[model samples]
Target: MTAQAYCPDPWTPTAGENARTSALVDRFVELEAQVARARAEQATLLVSLAEIAVEQGRRSGSESEYDFATRSIAAELGAAARIPEGTIRGRMADAVTLVTGFPATFAALQEGRISEPHTRVIVAAGERLDDDSRVEFEGIVVSRAEGVTVGQLRSFARAVAEKIDPVPLTVRQAEAMALRGAWVSPLEHGMAEHRMIGPAATIYAIHDRLTQAATKLKATARAAGEPDPRTLDHIRADVLADLTLTGTPTAGDGLDAIHATIQVTIPVDTITGIGDDAAFLTGYGPIDPDTARRLAGNAATWVRVWQHRDTGALLTVDSYTPTAAQRRFLTARDEHCRFPGCRQPARRCDTDHTIPHSHDGPTTVTNLAHLCQAHHRLKHHSPWRMRQGPDGEIEWTSPTGRTYAHKPTPMVRFDAEAEVLMPDLHLSDEPPPF
Candidate 1:
């Protein structure tokens, strides 16, 4: 037998011809333990350094030393290869000091609890404050962090802002506040359409543009009693145009055909007590656990199920029964989607049939699979399709219908250069350290 010829065993580890498989297992365990300790230490050091750097900036008046300290820490972190410079500075500022960086620094504020937005206000305000006042301001925030819940923290921030520097005090502020204490100056706004060429933008990006255009057209729409500046049909068409303008793989017959879809309307019952649609997990996107459980809870109650061996059992008004062996096969062969490059846990992935259940596929281990929601939808609706090849690789076909073979996820591969630095499990009590 050769490596890559068969998947490595979870319990039975076979090594070089004469070595005991158990020895390989022992080495693996030892290595795992070592990695755990290294990660824990790294997290502690990083957070501790952040705390120290913030203090030094406050107490050490020498601009040269502060600059040197910052440069040194940044350099050290960069060399580590895993730490992002923007992320590092932001963490330190939010968690320890309040001098530099914008959004990243805000993250430091929650320590681990609040959120990026909450910290942004503090950093934005700090920009206008003098060094002494800024540090004083940070001190107040740090004190509040010890006992503040999320709601209290937001309120406390308002109090802190008032204490440090209540709204710009000079002529610039008087002119900026045309509407009194109601809003930030309109001058602060800027339009950002990062990909104007593309037809598809995020709902967040779309919302911003809509806000800008809405304000510009607000008076006319309101006078006419129109609900929106633009009609829904216009928006949808424009959005499609947006995606097309942005470089989607429109040239390919493979799934760049965004216009296609398969609508599967399985009749749903009011799941015991839940009001929300119970989501079927396809892969690792964010769906609630209650949704995952709903399908399972009502599995037996499904009077008629459309059993697709590879995709798992789906209950419609139609029905069928599985042999006892098939049930055991489902439990053993498929815990989740077998798609490479995905880790949503087995339970969260859809149980797919290796062969089409509609084509009289057998309910056997070799005929089962699990795909997460994203991939599942792609399989059924998009131009993308899946097929088990002769070599055992699950080939994914694109919109153009070209098949791309996805290798299994390298879950076990941890190169020395690729490991994530450990997060501080314990240490600073500030912000909460998300």
Candidate 2:
């Protein structure tokens, strides 16, 4: 046991009766901190040992680190502790990280400035690099320490992962991985199938609903039956249970599309003007009433109807007062992200107000259009704005304040009586004369 193990925590504790309660609480916190430190050190030591083990393996005919850590830590802790070989190696792997991370991590822990998750992250980082590889990592962490606190180092590491053997963690990395993960691929595929076959649903939302519905089926099965019949395990259970569990997929044929959901932030005065039954139109063209407000009885994401002056056409929007329905409607009508050849689906695009709402841009069809998150950020972070004309054409102003005209959509109509083209196929239109 170390001296730090007896140190007190700074949190103002609960009300207690005994005089020793304060000291007890402090000691308990100290013990927990010490345990945390021990876990981290164990991990760090393991990392250094792994380096040693790897070197030894090269020298002694490909021996594993598992053998080395067991022999090493056991001698230090003693045989009576009867530590398992894997446990010691795991601990040493943990220790290897503390070689660099300990100073910053311990400092944060002692000061109670960081969450346990953060400390564990550094510990894990060290283990990944180990001893021989860690010096480079130490440099990276030190170089990254400032922004690394925000976990951006992981993001940065992940962005250029091919250069590093063990890729770092980051939001972008997670998203890419999510798209590639086996389960997510099927989920996205299912959503795509639904989009093409059933309705124009937000792919992400459809996956979520399917996952939820699947989970509910699983829970229901578990509650009612034993031996989850679906399993091929030794213990025989209800086979019907497993079949019943994957509910959402079975019900998918009957599923309806949940169109666009936009988050609206606006002033109260603007909402009063849009009368009740203010339904926001989803991107795929379904409208939802003020149910959020009706359910909570507090104002939220109120919908608005924007009537075009010349066209007499109405588009819905979501704002603190304005709705994004018009934004959704415009994006789908345009096809793809309006950014030249972006190819990102219409549903994923962010409906950006060409004139920022802060500048009093109305949530009308012409004022709203979709851009993917990257371009939406570009529009804000860069000096850019988008303008829509009555012809439904969008003009984009670049960061340099230079404007580019986006070409109009090509018109096509089926001519049933026209001569067909293609050797074995036809597009149901007349071919242009050669």
Off by over 4 Å in 2: 1-31, 40-83, 110-116, 123-207, 211-248, 251-434
Against the true structure, what is every candidate's RMSD? 20.4, 22.2
Error of 2 at 382 (Å): 45
Instruction: Give the Cα lDDT of each candidate.
Output: 0.41, 0.41
Give me the runs in candidate 1 sitting further than 4 Å from their true place: 1-29, 57-281, 287-434
lDDT of 1 by residue, 342-391 (tens): 54434334556555455555444334455766666555554445666322
Task: Please give, for residues 307-336, the per-residue lDDT of candidate 2 as tens digits.
Answer: 355563345455523333444235334434
| Candidate 2: 10-residue stretch with minimal lDDT | 418-427
lDDT of 1 at 368: 46
Best by TM-score: 2
Clashes of 1: 47
